[model samples]
Target: MLPRYFYNFSTFMSMFPHNYLIYGADVSIVGATALIIFVLTYFKKWKWLWDNWITTVDHKRIGIMYILAAFAMFFRGGTDGLLMRTQLALPNLHFLSAQHYDEIFTTHGTIMILFMAMPMLIGLINVAVPLQIGARDVAFPYLNAISFWTFFFGAMLFNISFVFGGSPDAGWTSYAPLSELQFDPGPGENYYLLGLQLAGIGTIATGVNFLVTILKMRAPGMTLMKMPQFTWATLITSIIIIFAFPVLTVALALLTIDRLAGAHFFTIAAGGMPMMWVNLFWIWGHPEVYIVILPAFGILSDVISTFSGKKIFGYTAMVVSLAAIAALSFTVWVHHFFTMGAGAAVNSFFGVSTMLIAIPTGVKIFNWLFTMYRGRIRFTTPMLWALAFIPTFVVGGMTGVMLAVAPADYQYHNSYFLVSHFHYVLIGGTVFGAFAGIYYWWPKMFGHKLNERLGRWHVGTFVLFFNMTFFPMYIVGLMGMTRRMYTYPSGLGWTALNLIETIGAFGQGASMMIMAVNIVRSIKFGERDVTGDIWDGRTLEWSTTSPAAEYNFSVLPQVTSVDEWWEEKKRGVVRPDHATFKPIHMPNNSGWPFLIGLSFFIAGFGLVFNWWLSAIVGALGIITFLFLRSFDYNTDHYIPVDEVKRVEAAAGR
Candidate 1:
């Protein structure tokens, strides 16, 4: 048994301190949990949630789960952002102690990037890619379930840090010397190392699965050139993930060894050099930036071309640019630390390589502009986000190029200027694109549209507040405001701008809340979309019913053009042949994924507490499940022809 101190009242209560802020969080978490339980009990939805979602192998349902999880993380990460801003709102404010602020920022960066943006984009991919390619499901459906569950468990492990022990405070990068066993001997960095290892495995598997899916599973007539641009982006992004993630996996594993086994992979006192860690990290990290943004680029392409009622102008050029960006992404890691004495030759080579990415990227921007030029445009919520992205992303890109100058980067390194620049791109790029995608695909995902009036309010306030929050950081950074500072003395002259930034952060938070409200309101009573093409979209995803049937299409679509669905729409009859109805082979939903996720969570939790016996039990559970799965040959079922015909007829397909 564990020691009595481990479960002492004071220790139990430490996670929820007796302060107003913590009390508020405690109330919110408890109240939300109670409300959910009450609603589920009232509606008798536990079985429904379990059968339909928890055990689901269906790609569309899994995608919805991913989005739900991502949004929850977004709120969590956003709360961390608010706390950091609150602390920095005034000079020398003691609202949050230094340790607390460090933990918040670390969690904020790690969650937003790893748990929030990644899952959101992956969710979009899951929902759209197979549908776009005219496949009934991804190539390996059981593996898909495993991927999501692993990711879910990984995120859960990372999130439980504060509750069990102290949160990771060495920043998301978890640099060496700082993160070594001596400087940080807690289970906090252990969470960072292990949580990411678990999640990164799933990510790598997803990459291979999608890569194989795109490579071999497309509809009969679709050639590479004929594939939808979003599918193309999915292919390239998956390749990046496949190529880039192993480096991270190795890096994390080595760091884990250093921390747990007392190895000398990155400890300063040992022969290990910390610079190797930075290099390996950025090798994966730079490509990761592209991994998140490229899908959004694909999203913007679909959104602009649809809303403008134009074939995406220069489709071939867009593909080339995407491929170019992917290739260039791997060569620019050194630019992340030009001031680290990598020498002029090394820095210059990386700097020039970094700027070269802008060339292909700029080509894409111009292509989007051309697609909208003189075309009939509908300024819907998704299109509004896209339109806003052009100018804002351009500014971010410009600043990025400025940062790429090796000599000049010495000045901007680790400053608020660097912070401002990235938010401009990432928030302006990935977040904007995510919101656009959410709005654009709401009908397809939920069978109804979100309120456009409220959507406009959401976008308007978000953009305004986003600029107010980060744009001034550039000014303050030039005035010598360094980052990672919890508080500063009153004479620093950073107070006014920090206050503006805090107000902006809260404004952004409020807009996000309004967005949540809009989703709920619309789901209860929004415009129903019987026709699947809610946006007159130019891809195969719009060819199916809203919320899509289990077998995405009754008959696989024969693709011939880049905008095959649009071409079909122009001819006005996309009716599938009723005579061709057949039984569909589908994977059976299994409870094992949830069980597997639970086992991994248990192992991760035990490892955090150094409870080796508990960890061993959980690990054995994992092995047992794997053994059971390997021998159990019955993994699939068939949807009868009659059921397919009935569903198709009801959907008016």
Candidate 2:
């Protein structure tokens, strides 16, 4: 009874599977969506949302939106993980088909890295960096909005494949030959290429935006050496993003051409080399690791020093180590495919380059340790996460070093051991650090603190369940169990370890639920942070009011030393008089950024299904918006001095 167009779409049936599990998912999604719609409608917040959130380009608001999206994606990715673990919990389990498993794993990796980790860190950067550096806002407010919306829409396009077409099953890496049109020949892979392409464009813009912001916008008298550690981390990470993301762009473009235009850029039959894809991928991939992590490193430095009641030890060395790590990240990409027969000479060079990174990393670890030694350490939730990171990351780092050995990697390559090591590094290093930053800065972002007891519970359970989940992967991995297997026979001695990992996975899920509850409960009843300096903080951000004014600083701060706010506190330095207040010029919000993102999403969806007409419409819309933005001269306004004074007075400054 279906139309001819419906039958023409080969993968449409896969989207609506006959399985009961997918039916449950469908019902849950519908119910949740309806509930959200009902609440928004009943509250009459549509216009409020449109005017204040969707059209606004305030860095802090944009940052909050990014974090919200990241958290949502984390749930989706985490659920995918739990489902995969459930399937593997017992031998011969048919909870998921092999094909479904492939799709789930692919989405899991892609979502966690691109949608969850990257956005969470970048969100924190946006929320805190401008305030720390005493800048009113990023250099290009509109461009910043563009970055966020494009990333949002791109993620939307990628996620919808699960229900609209079919999910990408080529792994997050999307290795060529397997990812080629001749092999995949579906809308799913096209979604992967175009979705990442859209998001990657936004990422590159963010790097440029922040790079210019930090280099040009710091407070007066704040030299490069005098900047806060998180700001420095943002700076270095921006450099890595600028240099590294272009390679990814090119690789994705080449693959897109191969898939859509009959090009053979990554195809073997037409003289295309598949390994070139791997080389290009890792060229971006290895540095991509640092992109998410360097910011966390910056966060830990600030948090560690703040809670320890001491200045960070070896500040110069820490900066040197950060830069060293960023520079070395590019040289070690070949270690990812060391077993690919790139010859011993090539492998040796990359392996050594990989291990060389450990020196700077170890220096950072020791610096954190030394900073904590003999200090009045406060065991706040954020500080606790920081402390837990040291030992967990150490295990991850040692395992990484072991994997870096070219000859030794042959045994561990593609095993559960490798899975364990990857999770330990990413979850231990990046996730732990993100949690710390969130807890440390929650008050600054929201004008209230998350409940301390609930936060402690969240951190405790997360760290415990996290270890229980991945540590055993090492043991079973060495016992010859491989990664990405949906089911295994019982006699292989892997069932017990798999079951243990499954239980831990669910516990981790519960921990995330605890965090969700903590956030929701704290929003209404949490302790208010009226003083802004709730942590007795060190940076310029603490000098501003909680949830900072629209213009971050009423007057640009004059910084004279590292931890300028702390120094000001020591001297009992009063803020400048309101008599000094001046009109502040701020960028007017525009809807073009949102429209542009929508256009990209439309084009991406069209391209996924090879619908050229829709793609052309989206491309034209993008051009139209850009043209409009160019002619719009009314893009800024000034807040009078009285408004600034009123805002300051309301904060009781």
Candidate 3:
């Protein structure tokens, strides 16, 4: 008690073993202060955020949230891509260390697949599926809310790994030996396992949600045969997600037990078989690619039809091919590791399946071509991306077939060529389709059109850069350049191509920046389009209001054919008569989903620091939030029938 300040310092010092406890206390105090400030700022306004944004189970809002998360993660992953690209831009650069490169790639792949592409696809599906199917909302709105929050939480956990401790560096696949505890003595791998486990739950839930909605909630007049092609793609994608994601969950769980508790599922020293992990991972991984690209295929089908002013050609054949591809995707996982000595029979079987996929995929290409063959085509930005897909995907597919030759794979496996092969398809197939879908649907989602001039600039820059960046990797792979090396010797004749690739990376980055600017400008002052039939859209979505309402269709649409809305326009079926007035019940907003997300953030920190107390507190926070939210039984209410009638009347005008 010699001095009051000295006493305070002593107390703080006593709380920590060394200086370690100081950061913890400081964080705790800051968090406590922030909580107080949050409460004070919203003293009486808590209801506003809750009612307006949080708990409203509107599909469009949910979709926006998913897309928002995806975009945020995209930049984060892209920066990682640039880092990796720069690292390999020259021989023996040593610009970044091996450990850093490992984490960069691991985070990039994990985030790109789980956070970027998956959510982008899901967001588009959420916004478009209900409208396309003529339904008011998803079949289970509460489940939809839960799924979105769960995904948000998983992303939060993954990001938190960067701040506290480390992120997984075991590549996105997290193969064994490297993934084992003895090899990776840090929290990174654990973060990956836990984060993905959480995300897997959300992904599986989403699959179930869409499946039930598509199968059971179609409008009274709609039948399977008359379903839009996008819905068919969604159906197959969901089936694959539901079945495949669970396998991933199991694999992650096994890995977690092995890492945390020494259970020996993948450790050779513990009588475990590492190949089991490989098998389980590929079981999920192969289908996971289809899970992404299939929906893109569907988007292309619909967009090409709309812009071409024609119905999708050979619709039945397209559907059949999708089903076949989905079936075949599951059987081709072994092909990924053909060079790993899986034996001639195993390799031969997977090679055939791998090559077999091209047939259905080729059929889809022909169908798209025929759809655009005789019809008048508009060169909209979305159509531009679709057209770009033709050559880009074909190149990737050709490399894929080349790799399918098991002997050739022996030469290409783990080489830069294989890397080029996947980037071609993954980027050309999934990334291009996502961009096209955004351009196609932006009017309906945002009530304004993206700047067409800027859009063209972006497409032109990105296409040229993307090909320039990846095309040479094929040459490098053929010249015996292996992948995953942090540095390479200069005399391998890989220098010129690598430098060219780096320049391409910069071009792609600049193009992305242009897109970001375009979106921001569009939201502020871009020209708005009033034509409900933007692009003379053939799907039900175009029939709804621009920037679709929270309840979607006020009166559920009746689908009389596959291109129901298109057919309606042709027949001059301008409006469905409003029989009577009824209140539209909608989900009320609640803060608990966000509260749940915040708790996961805290729990992730706790796990990273080995703080048992913080973990307990976080768990309590999550449980309390969920429990309080469950007591909210305010799901059903009515949208006034008069209100609905008036809105429809105005829409007719």
Candidate 4:
């Protein structure tokens, strides 16, 4: 049987004459573009932007760009969430048609996970990790530039779907039979597959890049075990990315061939098994959850220890926990579909593996608590986020454990209850952790502290409404509300809760806007940190100047302990001698990465509409650029001693 949403790939609904939603989107896009153009024209800063930012290979600058882009995607995805809320707020609400609703949610999930969360984390990593480990930059600065630009263009290609082509209506997973060309006959699914493929390529490169960086680039005497928790988190995350992302690459490639070439790899006919796609996706997907979460765990560990004025209690155990989680993450993919007739033996094995993860996780929690035990704990905004994450994430984990029970999962499968549980885990873990890191490292990134008063307000409002928004989902889900239904009839007793959820959604949106306002306000008025160690931080990053110089260190600090900088501060020691400084060799700026990203994007756009000629031209451009890069050997330049001294002196070093 054909799926409910099946349609031809070439279908384009030309009903825009009367569609308010399409018109609204069109007006918004136009207005936003006009505003951008007007601002750029008035400021005449495009040259400045291009010279410094667009082509720069600096890790810190690249990281900031990632954050900026991620926030924009967040807004886009969040709006989609609000639209869904609006539709479900009342019974039979026609705020969106069924097809439109499916597209919105699909885009929301994809954007939040791929464009928003992953980039945000990568950006933060690019910003802080090199500094934290006392490295000048990532293992491959040019490759880092390529990674960022490719991701940027990939995100743009995906975002343009609603305007230029039809939006994808399949779920973010885009399960096989439904995602096949017959059911999803549009450029939308193609965009999803290819955009992610392009972005995933960059991500895999990033994983390899950082894996080498973290492994080989630490300052002298900084052993693997003595690295900061966040660095350790990043290291593990990079490893997970390397091991797990390739599965996605292969899976997406197979699906793309299946769709475009009429291959039956995942189709029900011709020996194709749809279950293989599920297995492959979650094999990558489950670790992806950890890929995002383990970093947060690392961030939380740092926040807890810093605010409590204590060393992390289970330093060894913390490292063990992170590694264990990454290892265990791959073993539990079967739990996602225990009810798909995998039988008791298979399900039980996965169920046990899934449940076992809680041990290391619980160990991490206790370690944080023990760090806080008998210490003076400051309830700073970052610390507050760490504190809130404990119980909330614990609850999320409990619910996850609940779902892992195979027989029980059979009941909860496809229910909003599962949706609520993961949200609790994801929001509680990743979202709060990101905020904590943002607040903790704000000065390091931008040279000014975010306003404390505004930080408090933002956190309070967001946490309150976040709970308000999704907590009731558990209730409604248990009350028989199935997942992904566009509407419910008036008499199911779900109206009141759904209405409350919508109100909460609005509150969350308002809180995010306020956070944005706080960011803008802080740029000029926030506290100035001439001293880099604003938080009395314990890592290598705090050993340098705020808004660190291009060469992160004039000379690398030799680490003697886990919190080496903290130990040095306690001993009243200063920095390494700079009088004998040598010239610093750094990579020169290049525009090749930007051009290559553009070439890939053009090729992808051509492929989206099956424009063979355009695709060919774009492919040729990409090959030409690669050839040009091969012949270019003047990629490095030196900062002489005088210039290095000048920059260091200006930072009060």
lDDT of 2 at 50: 85
lDDT of each: 0.89, 0.93, 0.85, 0.89
lDDT of 2 by residue, 1-653 (tens): 23533554655655555667666777887899999889889999888888999999999999999999999999999999999999999999999999889989999999999999999999999999999999999999999999999999999999887766778999999999899999997788988888899999889999999999999999899999999999999999999999999999999999999998999988988799999999999999999999988998999999999999999999999999999999999999998899899999999999999999999999999999999999899999999999989899999999999999999999999899999998998999999999999999999999999989989999999999999899999999999999898899999888888999999999999999999998999889989999988999999999999999889999999999999999999999697799999999999999999999999998888788877777888999899999999999999999999999999999987
For 1-653, candidate 1 gives per-residue lDDT tens digits of: 45643554344345443456655666777798999999999999999999999999888988888899999999999999999999999997899988888888899999999999999999999988999899999988888888899999999899877555667899988888788888887788888887888889888888998999999999989999888888899999999999999999999988888887889888767588888898999999999999999999999999999999999999999999999999999999999989889899999999999999999999999999999999999999999999888888998999999999999999998899998999989899999998898899889899999999999999999999999999889988887898888998887778899999999999999999989999999988888989998788888999999989999989888888888899998888658788888889899998887887788878877666566666787898888898888887889989999999899989876
Name the Cα RMSD for model 2: 1.7
Candidate 1 residues lying further than 4 Å off, grouped into runs, are 1-27
Order of quality (lDDT): 2, 1, 4, 3
List TM-score per model, in order.
0.97, 0.98, 0.91, 0.97
lDDT of 4 by residue, 47-156 (tens): 88888999999999999999899899999999999999999999998989999899898999899999988988898899889998989999999999999989999899
- Of the pair 2 and 4, which is ahead by TM-score? 2
Looking at model 2, residue 330 earns an lDDT score of 90
Q: Judged by lDDT, which candidate is best?
A: 2
Clashes of 1: 0
Number of the top candidate by TM-score? 2
Backbone clashes for every candidate come to 0, 0, 9, 2
For candidate 3, the 10 contiguous residues with the lowest summed lDDT are: 13-22
Give the CA lDDT, 0 to 100, for residue 413 in model 2: 94
Better of 1 and 3 by lDDT: 1
The superposed Cα distance between candidate 1 and the true structure at residue 377, in angstroms, equals 0.7
- For model 3, how does the per-residue alpha-carbon lDDT over 88-201 read when each residue is reduced to its tens digit? 888888777787788779999999999999999999999889889988888887778778887888887886565455568899999997898999866788888878877787
